[model samples]
Target: MTYDAVTEQDPLGMRGIEFIEYLSPHPDDLGAVFTRLGFRLVARHRSRAVSLYRQGDMNIIINADDIALSSRTVQDEGDQISAIAIRVANANQAYHHCIQQGAWAVPTRADVMELKIPGIRGPGDSTLYLVDHQHKVSIYDVDFEYVSDDHNPPALIGGLKFFGVVQYINPESTAEWIRFHARMMGFRALPPQTRFGILPQGTILQSPHGHFYLQLIEPVGDALFDAEWYEQLARLAFGTPDVPATVRILRERGVSFEDNEFAHPDTQGAVTAGLSFGINFEIVRCPATPESP
Candidate 1:
């Protein structure tokens, strides 16, 4: 399918990340890591082996359901980011538009009790889910049951917010991926002078609504192709008003951070030591507004 640019406006009416999902064979193990990072288990999926954790405005879905479609893709990878759900004005229209833009659709099979959420293939085996944020009903309202008495999740220490996600791309494929996001999803490349946190060696693309970002990192200096790394969504970065204070708070919670000359903690940013399944989190010194210049 070929989709022409529908309008000058963002075709998807994209807002921000609804949630970042991780598929794992061991959900409890990964759940511990999230807990130490200050997330609270708020809900459980109605029909599957899935749970939702929240911190402030950020929502993370941990899918350990063996029967779930995305779980099959990450079964061998131990624990990996399987999908990123994006909030939009209309889920159906967004899904159709992306497919017309040459994006491959991931078939949906919602049961009689569930809502049929549309999705498309993303880099690697990941899926990009389209969810309508303007609707009166929420996707979780239909699929998940609340486990917490308090619906509002408390703020994370040091005022953390979703900064962006780091995606490992194939060597020399940066331009191609950039075009895919630009044409299909309405992401715009940032200027070279604008950098975020530490470990800044990638092309940063901001969502149309300027809420979150996608950092595309190509393998460095003639690096051989590693199927394990190519086109995979690697680490998640959270922006904090104070990096040192955030690190201190996490350290108190028994989270160890990498402390070295190049990547040590500072006002600019900090990197956490490898957590479950080589998943590391980056603490960047950025405003709550991630799209700010």
Candidate 2:
């Protein structure tokens, strides 16, 4: 029997997100902000100044090493999304597939990582790492040493999942990005009516795996010509069964949310106050993901 379009179009064997990495000089400060969002310091890289934070199924890496910033694509000075690791069937195959499809290859450095993970350049100064997870070895076991014995750190807000990321694109690049994702990763652009979270003003691309989304948002009218506007991964969004309850618990944990027209705690979703590095978290009104029968 033939499979559906999503399965038939998935050339890279894309699974789901493994981890999102951030490049921050002041990792301690970033860690504090993450802690406020209920992430616990779980692991530290064996060879680099990178610490892994975890909450539920989400994994975040904070890379603070100068060597890492120098060798890889760290063009900007401020803290931003450096890389996002995507689990695939075969890291080598996935990496080569992207390169064959006109994707820019990021050279693998033996000194930086124990596992020779292959990757390509993504939007802004970010790389998308293709990891061969559980093919033979788990990437974490090879690269990280557990600092916290708690393997499964429950989120403060129950049923939280790494829903997706919000990417700010340069003006008039929304369609360009949509086509890029469709061609490269088998992502389908949902109908315009399809939306998630409080600030719903963008094109949403659904992954072939149906595990996450990538919302591409272009600059607004005034910011369209703003000299400072640049394309970058802007926000990390999580999905929960209840939005107000999630907001309340996070508030008790000392997390302050932006109470403005764009975002509020009482809405279907709430956007957390941004950190100094421009990173923000959005809690959407998506239900607890259903399990297969």
TM-score per candidate, chains pooled: 0.90, 0.90
Off by over 4 Å in 2: 1-6, 70-77, 287-293
| C-alpha lDDT of all candidate models, in order | 0.82, 0.79
RMSD of 2: 2.8
lDDT of 1: 0.82
Q: Cα deviation of 27 in candidate 1 (Å)? A: 0.8
What would the TM-score be for candidate 2 when compared with the true structure?
Answer: 0.90
Candidate 1: how many backbone clashes? Answer: 1
Off by over 4 Å in 1: 1-9, 69-77, 225-227, 287-293
RMSD of each: 3.9, 2.8
Residue pairs with colliding backbones in model 1 are 3-100
